[model samples]
Each structure stands twice: as C-alpha cells, then as structure tokens.
Target: MDVLCESAPNDDDCGTRYSSSSSEDDERRDQGVAMTYMTLDSILNDNSRMFEFLRSFGVLANKYVCATCRKPMSCVKVATTRCGDGLMWRCAKDKVWRSVRKGTWFEKSKIKLKSIVLLTYCFCMRKSVQSTCRITGLSDKTVVDWFLSCREICSALMKKRGKIGGPGVVVEFGESSFGSNKYDKGRWMAEVWVWGAVVCGKDHGELVLNVVEKRDARTLQWFIEEHVENGTVIYSDKWDSYEDAEEFDLQSFAADHNYQFRNKVTGTMERYWKEVKRVLEGGKRRRSGLQSHLDEYIWRESVFVHGCAFHSFMQSVGALYVPRVED
Candidate 1:
C-alpha cells in the first residue's frame, strides 16, 4: 500500500486531473485500490485498509486516547461491524471501546470517510451538486451542506493568506452585479454587488473578492486599504468611486470602458472579472452564501495556478481541522 507523495506537479495535476488522470493515481492510493472521481467502489470491501489510509493522511488519528478511561487506545481488527469499519479502538485496563472515527473530522459525519474524501475531490473539481449527489449517493441537502462546509474551510484559510498586491505589483479593481430578474422583465428583483481586486501579470497572482453593500468612494477606498498593500500600481475604469485612489499611496490608472472595454493595460483584470462572474452566474446558490462561494473561487483560482489542487486542499484540511480526542 503506497501513499501518493507527488509534489509540485505541472499541467496534469491541476483540477480533477490529478486524481482522475491515470491508473497510477489509483495504484498510489493504496493496495490495488482504484479510486477515482466517479466511483470509489473498489475500496469499499476493505474497511481496515481504508481506515489506515485515512490515518496516513492525518484525516484520522494514528494514536488515540480513551476519554472515559484516560488510557491509550489500540487499533484492533474486529469480527463484527458497528462502527461501519471493522476496526475498533480498544483500551487495555477498563475495556473502554471507541469508534475509529471518534474525535476525528469524520466523527460526526454519518457518511463514510471514503465518501467524504470523494465529495471533497468533486467539490475541488467544481462538480455540480447533482453530479456529486449521483456520484456519492448523498442526498441533495447533504451535498449542499457539505459544499458550504468545504467553502467555510477555504474562507478560513483565505483570511490567513494576508493581503494581495504589494508595491510594484499591478492590481486591478472591478465590480459586477448578480441577482434574479423580476418577472422576466430584465429588472433585478434584488441587487448584489461583488467587488474584487486582482494582481495582474503573466504569472497568476493573488486576488481579493467580497460582497460589498455599496460601491461609493468610501467603500472602494476602504476595500483597497484593507485587502491590498500600500504603493500598489492599480488600474480600473474611470469611475467616481475611485477618484480618491491616489490619496492612499497607490498609483492608479483609469480606462474609459464606454469606448474601450479592456485596454492592454487592464486586460488581465477584465478577463478575471468575466471568469468569476461566469461561474457565479452558473450556480444557483442563495444570496446569503455568495460571500463564501467567492472565497472558494479566489482560493481555488490561486491554487489551481500552482497545480496539485486536490492534494493541496487535503493538506490544508489536515492543517486547519485538528481532531479532539479529549472531547
């Protein structure tokens, strides 16, 4: 049973291709196991191996302490299955027993660890909700909730990534609206504004995206100060909202969008805005969850540029979500 330790991949590792590209990925998964995006049935018959595989990835604890007995728990192969996996954590003296999933990320989830893993892969691949439901045999509500849970994890990580666009970095600002049209009259029943700033270059740089209540001067300047570093070379359309950009130590350039949509100077940010808005429009997420989805988008966008999307995301999950055996 070999674990995948591929690091710093290239074109093949981006998005779902990392796990679904070839049989080598499945062989590296564990044993003669064949794990892919569409199906995980090959790994189902061996629960004990599945348990150890997850343990190797920090998804489960390799060593556990019994909370009730205050003693060490040993992984023992059991004959019967009550914990869904035929493995149990047994304590020596008091005969205290705990499920293998106790105090792990999969602790409260009724779904199996394998399924959760696949769900995460699908989510990273940007698979649709219906697609995930079909692949994982999970209810629609369960899939939606899990999708949000994944985004919350991304949002937490994004908050820790610090600010984007430092001195000498080319940063661009933009805004777009998304909402339901009223009675097919092309009138927005509700208006939601998405504000974003992206670092521009041939190499993919960082991004800052959020839902803002207003796009006034105070609002735009505030977002720039909060998310972008001082002395960044920034560009945007000639909007009154950004009239005071130079007041904050930023060198600002404004393109006239009426005559020219994307001048060569502002091309990168214009393309980024379209890509983001396209994905956001494709989904049917509620208005309240838009911020989290935006967080997910920016996180994925940045990571996708580096390749190894799924592996990196799983590493983040292990780092951010620590298990509590004492509880």
Candidate 2:
C-alpha cells in the first residue's frame, strides 16, 4: 500500500504494478483513489473554503472560531447523507458553543456555504429570490432566509462607511410614489413615497433610497444632508420642496425637460429611480415592509453601481472588520 501525502499528486505519480489476478479491479480502484485525492485537493484549494476543512480534521482548526463565543468549535456530527448533487455534511454544536455558524449571519445554520455563494451571485445579478431559489434548487423559505441574512451583512457594510457620495460629488435627486390607492378611496392604502438620489459620474453615482413620510422641503433637505456632502452639486426637476437649497449650501440646479436634457449629463438620477422602482415592483409579493426593504433596494442599487459580485462584496465587507456590536 502506497501512502500519499495530502499535497502529493494523485495515483498517476506512482508506478503501476500489474497483479495477475483481477488486474481490471486494480485499475478501477486506482482510478477511484486518484479521483478522491483530486476532490480533496480541490476542496482545500477552494477560495470560499470555510469550516469544512476544520470539520474534516474532527477539531475546529482555531480559525473557524465561533463568532459569538470567540472559542474554537468542535464538530459534533449529526447525520450524513448523499443528495443527488453531492454529499451533505450536517453537524451541530451546543447553543453556547456556537457563534454565527457557517452560511449565516447568525449562529448555527445548516445551509451550505456553496448554496449561499450561489444565492449571492444570483442576488448581485438582480435575480429575484424566487428565481434564485429555482436556480439553486432551494425551498422558498430557505432562499428568503438567505436573502435576509445577506441583507443584514449588507446593512452592516453600508453603516460602517457612512455616506457614499462625498465632497465634490455631483448628485441627482428624484422621488417616486408607489402603492398609492387613490382609486380605492385611500382608506387604509396610503402612498409609499421613495426618495432616491444617484451621484452622477462616468458610472451612475452610488444610489441612496429613503422612504419619506412626505416629499416636503424638510424631508428632501434631510435626505440630501444625510447622504451628500456640503458644496456638492445637486440636480433635480423643478420641485417646490427643493427651493430651500441655499441653507444646505448645495449647488442645486433644475433640469429643463424642454431643453431635452441628455441622460449622460442630467438624467442619470432619473435613470436610477427608474431602475430601483422596476426592481421594487418586479415581484408579485409587493414589498410591504417599507423602510428596511427600501434600504435593501438602495443597497442593491449601490452594489450594481460598484459592480461587485455578492460573494466578493461580502468578503470585502468582512475585511472592514467592523465590530459586531454596531450591527
């Protein structure tokens, strides 16, 4: 029996010996051994490799520390099964011993890391959660939970870096209303007004969306002050609420539709508003959780502008090393 180092090349590295009896069986066994070695190598080299490596060793490798308890984990094997796609490894830890578990923003989730990566890619590409579930072959509940977990991560990222658009940034601001039930006599149906601003640049400015109680001067000014810096150039349509721009020191300019404003120069903000509204209304569920949902919408828009894939963004987010207490 040849013992191969974990990093060594597969069975092909070893010289073959012919056994007169069952030569075919010997060849098949060698092939199987080679394939298994290759799979292990691939897993070890996987960029997204998380806890599985530690679990395979039967001791948490000190790196896969519990995010909550800050202690190394011990793999408590639960069950093993093979799905149509591949093998499944399920493990459990004491609630106290666990922290944010693999594949979750919280501790101790059973979802696979690969599934999370796939779902994140789908999300960054603007695929609906239902569509993502279909693509990943996950249940609706699982997909939704993953999405919410990702949203929490995204929110933490956004909070750490305050106000994306900064000094010398030129921003275009706009507002749109959805879920208005004027025809239904406006009983319990009130209009959900979304105020959006996109910085104007070679690409669209990182988008900011806020759900405003009303699109009044106070609200608009608040949005501008919160997201944009003073002395920034702001362009918008002629709205009375924007009249008090002098107080904010914002170089406010009104777009002239009669002049056929080009999208490259003047209509960038409007374009973002259109895109966000389209995405918000894309699903049949009609997002009723207004505030947090709008935050997520803005997050998606910003991600689109930054051209970040979901997993990459998540890794970059982790690099920020923000304290979990703030989250």
Estimate, for each residue in 32-76, the C-alpha lDDT of model 2 and write its tens digit: 211122333344333223334322222222234454555544433
Would you list the C-alpha lDDT of every candidate in the order shown? 0.65, 0.49
* Each model's Cα RMSD: 9.2, 12.4
Model 2 has an lDDT value of 0.49
Task: In angstroms, give how far residue 231 of model 2 lies from its true place.
Answer: 1.3
Task: State every prediction's TM-score relative to the real structure.
Answer: 0.76, 0.57
Q: Find the candidate with the highest TM-score and give its number.
A: 1
Report lDDT (Cα) of residue 284, candidate 1: 36
What is the Å distance of residue 104 in model 1 from its true position?
Answer: 2.6
Residue 245 alpha-carbon offset, candidate 1, angstroms: 12
How many clashing residue pairs, candidate 2? 2
> RMSD of model 1, in Å?
9.2
Model 2 spans with C-alpha error above 4 angstroms: 1-106, 112-114, 164-168, 181-189, 242-265, 282-294, 304-308, 316-327
